[model samples]
Target: MIVRTIRADDYPGLNRLHASVGWPQRSPDGWRWLADNPARREIGAPEGWVLVDAADRPCAMLGNLIQRFVLDGRSLYGATGFSIIVPPQHKGASRPLIQAFLDQPGVFAHYTLNANARSASLYGRLGLRPWPEQTHALKLSWTIDPLACLHGRLLRRAYGRVSAEAAETMGERLMNRRLWRPGPLRLPHGVVDIRDVSDSSPYGRFWGTLSEQGALIADRGAEMMRWRLADPDLPRRPLLLGRVEDGRLTGTALAMTAKTSIIDPPSLEIIDLQGLPGFDAIPLLARTLIRNARGLGAAKVRLQALTPDLLSRLGDLARSARREGGWGHGHAAFSDEAVAASWSPTPLDGDYLMCNRPVPPAAERQWARRRAQASRASKA
Candidate 1:
């Protein structure tokens, strides 16, 4: 077998490979974001690399997602692996594929999120290790809608005794007994307002301000924010909320809509939460997130890999994944020890933010039409 860079043509075969192992694959357009991304182009990183058999069919593959960050006033480049696969028949191809990814230059660090047991061991052998902080291994969750969060997990056991509908009714009544409305608190001053991505003017100089205080932070400037949200294949269109006070954004967050998996109901996953230091904007930001999530019919609001300061600001609803156990784990390898020590990894740092949701059928056709028009204009 020969190794080669991934191309647009390999999407179908890649999908086939995904199916062979019960993993979800994306449509051709869905796969385009990896290669067509402005960050990848600027950094000169390949979309991915694949090992092809003698017949020129891909047997194994490893995709690289590039990201840019700022650390202590210096810029840093990083790559995260995605959709890495090596079929059981081609066991030997695994290390080679991973090595190929590791060989990529101009990267200050490499990481992967939510690695399974098998993959974790493989990645460990190749020099990647989980984050040093115990917090990065914890999946801190906050229930936005108690009734919904209880349905499949806590309330399911009572189903054989009482009907699901009856159980739900009882749950609602139990919740109603307490006046737990955070509306008045989150808006103690009513200064916070909800705005669409078009009205993201407050974020104009947000990144510069943030990098001054934070040693390691993912780049989320105005243009980068627009690009990140513009990915056509993203599961749900993430809600970008900002805490606007005194005519500028005091705090902001990206609430990603998670359609959900087998046991849990749908939820609003907070990818990253940022706030200016002076006053605590997190509560206000959290309140806004919960309100919007409730309006959108989400069961819970979950945030993973929280920094210590951020975790402390999250008042109440602070529970681990299963009330005790954890489902979050971070794998990383950084060249600079000081940078690694200073790093407070958030969910935004890896491809998990983009691929967490189950892959749905591609429907964002406008991106294609727009690209075609641009192409035509360029040729003309």
Candidate 2:
């Protein structure tokens, strides 16, 4: 077996590997963006790594998205692992594939979301200690109908198009009627306005203020905002809402709606929320997001609290919201134990939202064709 950095020519092989493992093939445009984007390359090179057998055919691959972060008044680097693919025949090859990336220089740390129990165990043996902070996904609404929710759950189990459609319709009607109206947003004196804006809109001053405060945070400047929000493959175009006081930007939040299955109602998720230190703006932002999501037909609103201060404020408003924890581990190169412990990562830090996008019609057709071909190939 051989492991090497991915090259431009390896795009086809990578896609083939992904398909062979029953994953969707990325659009050509999306692949090129990942491979050639200057913003991504500015942090590191060669995308990620691929493992091949003696014949030079890829058996497994691991892709990384390196991101710049600020910690302890200094710049730090981190990477989020995504699209990890390994066929059943080469299941044992997974550990070595990840080990190769961890061995690379400047990698500091790596994180992933929703890893299986098996993978979690493997990561533990590699000396990555789980961060102690709890990553919560809170639901903002409490008006779901028991009957409709039960009906949708059963329909999902039946797994038919007609049943699925019925479930969604029922959910929509139930949620739309039960919507709870929050009080108007009350900003402190001198706070002028809050409204939605495009990702490319200027807010450098707002971000600079947050960065200067020295909390461990990923860079959320214009470059990252444009790259992440404008990606062609994003499931939904995130709402970039900001708070302005006296004509200067003070805070911003990115929210989007998602529904994974017929049984699940659409959820509004706050992927990133930031404001100046000591600024009591997140609560008002949360209220506005809940109202907007309700109007947009989402059944619930969710967000992760990245700091103790934000968590405390949100806890008061979303008292009935469900909470859960997330797991992560890292190495010293990324940051010292203290810095790593202080780091707070939201769902946006991983590829969670990216993977939730709706499949394009063309891609769906292509997937059906590929499945048919595979079925025939197996029988032959």
Candidate 3:
């Protein structure tokens, strides 16, 4: 039973393990990005960890170390997409393998991962606790339909003008905004390209940078957003993307509707919202989203507070009610990881105040059941 750092060459085997466990396939480019990501090397968990049985077969693996967290002005590390993919015969190997995985130096520092309640318990054993928080998906209620709201022709023209140079610059600017201080961005009306439209655009790039840089971290990103947009299994959840103007994508939103209960009005989740320098557009972006929600017959929209800005600005939108705070314990060789730290969490007193909403107990229980099921299934 050996637990060790996976090398770059192990990617294919890791990919195979993830696929065999009902996970999606990964492209070479994406996998390479994960392998070479700066955060992993800085924290000393570069390849995350792969557990091999005595014979040295790669029985299980966790994909990437996706987040860097800043708590009280210091940074912490968290793993996103961490998994153990032991074959059915080796299912029972997970417990010890996970224990060994965590024993790896720097493995637990500021690491945050979202699991069902049961997994949370496993984390507890490892000194990782649930950050008392509830994530909400907000669907804005808009007075207009999505089709009517589009200035499509204008956007197409705008996307056309976006050169790779512009893309790179906007991308870099957004990266700066997330990692450094926030300020107004001055942009000529024509230079931005909001076309890729989802978080993969400047905004998604910001969140990814945030996680990778140690500001804020999450368990998922671009791939999940891309997948959600095309997810066929979840029939109730329809996908939509919007840009403030053609190239300047100010916001991105996603919604999931339930099939069991029409009376169980569809719920919309604002997966990620990124506002450009002119912050005024953020409110408008919020409003447009709500209008879209109303069109879909959603009961109420849910939104997660990625940073303090959303909580502060939308804190008073008439329908904007406070949701519960999500909390977690993260640790990292803060000093060692600082060099690679690209971002930090917004000050607690800043516009980053997160509100907590009630998480239905039943929902929590259901989620726990599902997580336990996933854990058990993985073991099987």
Best-to-worst lDDT order: 1, 2, 3
CA lDDT of each prediction against the hidden true structure: 0.67, 0.60, 0.42
In terms of lDDT, the best-performing candidate is 1
What digit string (tens of lDDT, one per residue) describes model 2 on residues 1-380?
A: 88887777777888888656435467677787766644357666558888887977677898877767776567777776777787778777778777876776675566664354447667667655544234332223433334544665675567533333354333322233212322333344444332323443447667667778767778776666667766666544666677676667777777765554434555666776676756656666766776566565565666633445566756567666554333332212343566666566655665655555332333334445666887999999
What would the TM-scores of all predictions be? 0.76, 0.73, 0.46
Residue-level error in angstroms, candidate 3, position 322: 13
N/CA/C clash count, model 1: 0
Point out the higher-scoring one by lDDT: 2 or 3.
2
Superior by TM-score: candidate 2 or candidate 3: 2
lDDT string for model 3 (1-380, tens) is 67676776777777778556434344565466555544455676655667776777677765445344443345555543355466767665656655655555553343332333334455566554433222222213322223322332244455543443453332211011111121222233322323353654665664443344333332235544444234332323234444445544444443332211111223344544444444444455455556555444433455433334455555456245444323332222233444424322211111111111112223334445666887999999
In model 2, pairs of residues that clash are 108-334, 235-357
lDDT of 1 by residue, 77-110 (tens): 8888887778778887878888888889988788
Question: Candidate 2 overall Cα lDDT vs. reference?
Answer: 0.60
TM-score of 1: 0.76
Of candidate 1, the 10-residue stretch with the lowest lDDT total is 173-182
Winner by lDDT between candidate 2 and candidate 1: 1
